[model samples]
Target: MRHSDVLVVGAGMAGLMAAVTAAKSGASVSVLSEGAGVISIGSGAVDFLGYVNGKKITDNPFNHLSELGEMHPYNIIGAENIKNAFASLVEISNANGYEIKMNEEGLNHTAISIAGTTKPTYICSESNNASRILKAKKILFAGVEYLKDSQPALAVKQAKQYKIFADAEINSALLKSPFGKTHRVLNCLDLARYVDKEEGFNWLKSELSKAAAGYDAVIIPPICGTINYTKHFKELQNLGFILVEAVSIPPGVGGYRLRHALINEAKKLNVKFIENCNVQRAVIENGKCKSVIALHNNIAGALETEYTADNFIIATGGIIGNGIASTPDKVYETIFNITIDSPVSVEERSDKNVFGSHLFARFGVKVNSKLQALDSKGSPLYDNVFFAGNTIAGYDFPTEKSGYGVACSTGYTAALSALASK
Candidate 1:
């Protein structure tokens, strides 16, 4: 029987920003998530698209929405609001001790020239943010096995040119066996077992202990333990170290880092968090929601927990993260069970084309100007339930560098709207 002024579901960028905004505005916020927030698999830059009328080559958030609408018209609407969303994002980033930048060249959308492939690699120059951390003597890279393998070594080498000590190490303690012996299991996350094994964990400890000798901080992917991201950071800090988490690409499992960062920061803010608490369903009476039924788990296993709130932000994320629903047959929403405005013609292409060599993968939920989840009719699902980040739909941010920018923007906007309503 717990209650708060606002209840944020999901810990992704949108959800995190929403909760932070509400909490900062003097609202008691409770964030419920099944796992860590997404974004840990990224370059950690606030990506805004296009230029802002300067030689600096900045991006205009509004233009991003237009570009996205053009690319995936069926899924998203209200292109301009997306831009405004980012305007608010600037405030949040500054408050959080991170600098936000806009690229004028829009080079982030173009193919970066990689050695072997004629196609340029997809990269957002979060150089400014990355540069700040370069001051650190060392950076630790930890995550799922295949995740680290995705990038070409040259990419890491280039980052090193910028003066970053990138050390890639596997945490055997986090490795886990894919349920039942199946070949497909290899494709999934097996690193859980690696981290769990005594020998494996010991090996990592010995290696980190040795590296800890002189390094200033360790940059790790999301290696969340026991569902508490803040706890993991606390333990790491207790060991006397600073942890910088990068973004996680989808299906690749880099999202763990994104989730962990939110968890870590949320704790510092003293925000309340509840995990494994599924929203059985929401009771939206009238235009506002009154309460939600959440399923909780403990040593005794799953139990139903009802939570009441005055405001809410649903940032479950889009298709990639399971916030928006899709399958081999159809696509739709999972939480509110609303009909999604899917594309008229589905792109039935090979897996090779679908995933793409670039990070700007266009797949997931769609949103309108207000950052509200939309139905097949292209209307808002619930005014109170503001959407954010990858789930907002439209734009392929990885390539556009709009992901972080749009996310930060939409997150800020949603919070602003929520606060305004309050």
Candidate 2:
């Protein structure tokens, strides 16, 4: 049996943030995860809220929180807590050698994607700062030959369509394949590993200097080193070129770098991380969660391990992350088997339009302002148990573009609430 003051389930941004926050406040924290969360698949930039009332773009996302319904996670987290959460995340990133920069006015900035689509994000990697990219009069879209995901020519054509960059000259350039002919299809992971080495950096510098000549800023694939992205950014800056990293595709190396930094910071705070443990059930006693039973894999066979904690936080993520499971007529919280508040019938969940609202995306465990999990009747399930991240659903992530921000804010708030519990 393992015991801790705080036990957090999941290793995604929310779970990691909760563990780090609790541990820093002098609570003994243990984190268990089935696998790495959605970070690797997400764009590295932190999106607060990009759209409101459907596809309407708002300059200041924070200003429109009041417009959201009562069930929205941002409203439940409150504005002050959201600010504090971002501050804590920035501090953690800086301490771990990965600096994140946000606008001074707390407004969202436009981040250019590899496909040249502009996305509204609150905080972005210093290397991908939009302000620097916007200042350039001439921009060079650079790609590696044989790169599977990034297309320089296509990006240049798409970027030219946007009126925001009309004044800047958009050009395309292709450098030699960073990985040579070893692999037929070069992925972002390969590029990231290549850039981490000194020889690879030198090769890239030489190639970029030639391809990016006469251009004020060079937008390139996010090949920044996974562990030392900031270091690579500085080294590239020393080559006398203004560099901007494009928002990545799935298996995002930049996101992986951010995740690695968070995990390293958590370790510094003495947070115990237990990977490959799938929590199966929670033991409730006297209206409180006493412990959880997890399935652990070993050479012999699967083993059941009991972990007892004074308090527990569920950051297990949403349907996409498999924190909540759904069927034709039912939605369920996996660990506690709590009934999710969703449509009663399958017909109510189905939408005829392909890009229409998905009821399942909004199905998750409900939590109150204190971050405590609530039953269908709005009652706390366990006094010592709380929920954070995608588990506490109220908003659609794709439409709102508030998923990462909500995760960070709710995770931070959940930690504070858990630490104050009796």
lDDT of the structure predicted as candidate 2 = 0.84
TM-score of 1: 0.58
TM-score for every candidate vs. truth?
0.58, 0.96
Q: Show model 1 residue runs off by greater than 4 Å.
A: 50-265, 297-299, 343-352, 355-366, 375-379
- Give me the overall lDDT of model 1: 0.50
- TM-score, cand. 2 vs. native: 0.96
Q: On a 0 to 100 scale, what is the lDDT of residue 279 in model 1? A: 72
* lDDT by residue for model 1 (1-422), tens: 77887788887677777787677778788998776655644434444553322222323344334334443422243445444544444444433333333434433332211111111111222311232344565544333334433333444444454312344221221222223344453321234234345554454455456555554555433332212333333444555655444332333232333344445556666689897666767788886667778877543666777787766777776666677666555665566766555554455411245434222244555566555666657776676776666665555654444455555556666666666666
Cα-based lDDT for every prediction: 0.50, 0.84
Going through the candidates in the order shown, the clash numbers are 47, 0
